[model samples]
Target: MTDLNSKPEIDAPEGPAPEGLEIVDIVVGDGAEATPGATVDVHYLGVAYDSGEEFDSSWGRGQSINFPLDRLIAGWQQGIPGMKVGGRRKLVVPPHLAYGPAGSGHQLSGQTLIFVIDLLGVS
Candidate 1:
């Protein structure tokens, strides 16, 4: 069973990185739904798709984060909506949807990323 209160581990990716954004629901919640522009409070873990190396994690920090959907990466902005509070979701984000193509300056640029997110609240 998926645990809502703990950090999630992502399995090593297989095959080449996908060319587009992919969303999967690990646990569906019945609470308030997230809207396109809603601010959300969530616990999340992020890893590089190719290496499966962890890059960021709210869980590691021992706290959740709150941010507006519009302020997040494209994949997140696109994938997070329609998810409800108490849900857990997985997103496979291509470089374009994540940081961007190579040489974009950001360290994560040119890299595909995977994220497991647990939604705690939305407003």
Candidate 2:
């Protein structure tokens, strides 16, 4: 199970946040690669980019979430595409591609967000 209170270990970006989305591999997997329009199952931890305060986790709930790659936020839609099943990646999402200026819920707003995601499978 995931440790809900644990902060994510985000590496310093090789350069500035890219113009679109940035994905860094934490664990390279040999499973099937994710592609646009594919349904994917994943466990993820979301946090603020500046503070690393965890805001959401699927593992904390003891379950993984499944969704179509094209239906998620622009940042996620862009970043998750090229990952492989069983792979772990860190996604640095700029506000423009995430929730944008409106943000989402109460935890994120206009701030860049970071997510550590584990791709479980693609169906």
Candidate 1: clashing pairs of residues: none
Q: Compared with the true structure, what per-residue lDDT tens digits does model 1 show for residues 1-123? A: 998988999999899999989999999999999999999999999999989999999998999999999999999999999999999999999999999999999999999999999999999
Score every model by TM-score: 0.99, 0.81
Model 2 C-alpha lDDT versus the unseen true structure: 0.78
- Cα distance off (Å), candidate 2, residue 89: 0.5
Best candidate (score: lDDT):
1
Query: How many residue pairs clash in each candidate at the backbone level?
Result: 0, 0
Residue lDDT tens for model 2, 41-101: 9888887766666778886787889999888888888888889987888888988888777
The deviation in Å at residue 97 for candidate 1 is 0.7
Quantify all predictions' global Cα lDDT against the true fold: 0.96, 0.78
Deviating ranges (above 4 Å) for candidate 2: 1-19, 102-107
